[model samples]
Target chain A: MTATRRTTDTLVIVIVMLLVWQALHQVAGSTALPAPLPTMIYLMHAVASPRFAENTTTTALELAYALVLAYAIGLAIGVWMGAHRLSGVVGEPILVALYSLPKITLYPVVLLIFGLGISGKVAFGALHGILPVALLTMGAIRAIPPVYLRSARSLRLSPWQTIATVLLPATLPEIFTGLRIGFTVTLLGVLLGEMFASKSGLGFLIINDMSLAQSEDMVTVAIILFAFAAIANALLLWIEHKLHRRV
Target chain B: MTRVGAIRFAVIVGMIGALELACRLGLINHQTIIPPSEMASTLVTLLASGSLNADIARTLGEVMLVIGLSVVLGFAFGLVIHALPRVREALDPFFATYYAVPIFIFYPVLIAIFGLSAIPIVLIGVATAIVAMIIATLNGLDRVPPVLAKVARVHRLSPVTTALTLQLPAAAPYLFTGVKLSVSYGFIAVIAAEFILSPTGLGRDIADAYADFNNRRMYALILFLLIVATVVNGVLHALDMRWAERRSGGRS
Candidate 1:
């Protein structure tokens, strides 16, 4: 397809989707559903609100805490486990069990344990985020090139030295993959915590808006969250790509 | 079993037994974290009474619906992207953008529009699966060996047969990998959806239990959900391994 036709097709999809949304809004004719334009207006209004910065900052802080903790812990355990096959297998089953457990169900346990505080949210976020990182890092460590081990040994490197120089470098790509997965899942977890377990996060804002029947305000917040996610993911991807190239 | 397997098994059993013993001996709090005996008894009771049994059925019903829909819709769109280069190129960026834009962001809107039903959950699951499927199919196409393409040409195979038999089979492993990943993620997405907005199902049950600070109830619900998720995927993994073994033997 030519660029023009491709662009047109894209526009068609976007415009058509919006038009349908707008048409439905018109038919509803209630505050329950705002027209596309009205929603956009509300979105702009949300952006202007000082509360936008506060909510966004709250989510960002919680997410950073969760992501960092998950990565640090997952990497340490995953590297150790992945270094040995037997350990990997035994540990993997337990990890998989924990990982697959509908973490949402644990939120109650989390809330109970941590008592509706940031501690609870961060703990929940780290739990959601940690498993994939560990698994992915394990996968990465397993992929370490054998020739590097041979070379390191030939150079008379100690076990620690070999691991630091050869294994760590080789695992960087996979480690990044784990971190990316951790970020995505952690964001989800953090958002859920904020929504269900908090009084002030963006999630709280959303639930509050919904309860108040502030439909447009809710959508605005939702849109901003989506935008933030997109930007965060894009930034991570760029950094990962740069790291891969540099390494 | 091999000695190593037995040792591994022993280690795991010992760990669990130790934990149970700790709780029993008052080294751990059974109320805060139930002893294994208590947890097992709870499971047994719930299963016998059929309340938990029915709850599993309820949650599993919705999960199955989502998975069923994802398989159909994911493959349909995936095939379109695979076969049609024009369509694939045009939609690629949109898919990439969508991936970055957290689907959870849509939950509030979905609940508003659909009102906390299974439909919204399924939609989220299916949507999560779609891009993964398309990427898998596309990547699989690119993975077809050049030698295989030449062999297909030499055999004078029709284009359709080449796609179905050669390309699809070549892509089979990756396709399976994609589906597996998608299903795992799709399940997570659906559960999270329920946890976020639903009025019923496992997610809602957990939230309710949390609100009451009933650790036993909360832990029991989580364990139950874990078993369901693990059993479903474990079964799928077994099927996949069996299929691979048969195929490898045939090739040999």
Candidate 2:
């Protein structure tokens, strides 16, 4: 299909969906099921409110800091493991176990150690983010063509030169994949922490509104968050597409 | 034992021993980090007490229900979406971006609509899990080779027969992959729901333990959860491998 046709199709579908939702709201006539128009209005107001700005910044900042820490440590460890045979073998099982293990189960442990604040949330998010990056980085390095390494060695290139010219470039794609997955889980981890225990942030806003029985406000917060997440994911996917094309 | 096995065993033992030593030497606070021995004893005590059994059963039942529901609904959704090219194209972007949105965010809305009960919790799990199955199922069906369709037509098979005999078998692997992903995703979603919303279940108990600062119980519950997750994943992986082997053998 043409790009314009696809865009038109999507818009039509979205409109139909919204109409159906609005119809349901009208039929239900429940406070919980606010019509989309009203919900959108509430969302607009919420967006403009200082409170939303503060919470948005708080959540974004938390995610940013956690992701940065996770990226640095996870990249270093993953690269180290990828470079070393024995260390990778020793760590592989533990990494796999931790990967499958719902890291949310460790939220309580984090809370205990870091106390109830952004520190705990950041720690939890970083923990969630690290594993995927580490695993992917290890796989990427391991999968690098042995011929390239052999050739590099034959050239008598220094270790730094070898990594710069070969390993780093070769592993960039997989590293991007890891970053994408890590960003997602880190976002979830932080949100989960905030929901479980927090004084502020989007999660807290949702929980707080729910308790207060403010359905409109709650939906508004959810909408804002949903938009933020959807946009972030789309951006990452676009970057990946561009990078893949270049490669 | 394999070299890797020996190394893993050493790592675990070394970490636990280090923690135990730290506790004994008063270098680590018991309030923050419970010794491995104490955690083991607590696990034993909790098992003997039988209090954990009901919680485990409840969580398992909820997760099983969610996975079952997700499989059925997701398959249907996939079939519909796949059958309609325009619909699929229209929603493709949303579906692609959907996974990153923490479906947990919908819990409050669900609770508001359904009230504080198992209904909302189960709904949350199903909602979170169904998307993966849908994507997988669509991909599975899309992968059905055109040659197989031609073969079915040559045999004068009805569309229904063709789907049952050809398309399904061809798509079985992808469907199984969908189901496997659904099971694990459902497990995670259900546990998370229990933590935030449910009044009872293993997650609630863990939350309660955390609140009370019962480090031993908290660690013990987490350990049990880890075991369950690992065993389930291991079983699914084995099943996947066996299925692959059988398929390859049949092809050979």
Candidate No. with top TM-score: 2
**DockQ of each candidate's interface versus the true one?**
0.45, 0.65
Off by over 4 Å in 2: A27-30, A154-156, B151-165, B250-252
iRMS per model in Å? 2.8, 1.7
Candidate 1 per-residue C-alpha lDDT over A1-247 given as tens digits, one digit per residue, 9 for 90 to 100: 4778878877876787789878767765546567788788778777878888888888888888998899999998898889888888778867876786667766776765576778888888898888999998998988887788899989999988987888888888779878987888898888888888588788888878877777788877877787778777878878888878977
Candidate whose lDDT is highest:
2
What's the CA error at residue A98 for candidate 2, in Å?
1.5
Lowest summed lDDT over 10 consecutive residues: which window, candidate 1 chain A? A24-33
Superposition TM-score, candidate 1 onto the true structure: 0.86
Cα miss at B139, model 2 (Å)? Answer: 2.4
lDDT of 2 by residue, B151-212 (tens): 99799998668767887789989999989888888888888888876789998888989889
Worst 10 residues of 2 chain A by lDDT: A24-33
Q: Write the per-residue lDDT of candidate 1 for residues B152-231, one digit (tens) a residue.
A: 89999987788778888888876786777677767788777777778777777776776786667767777777777888
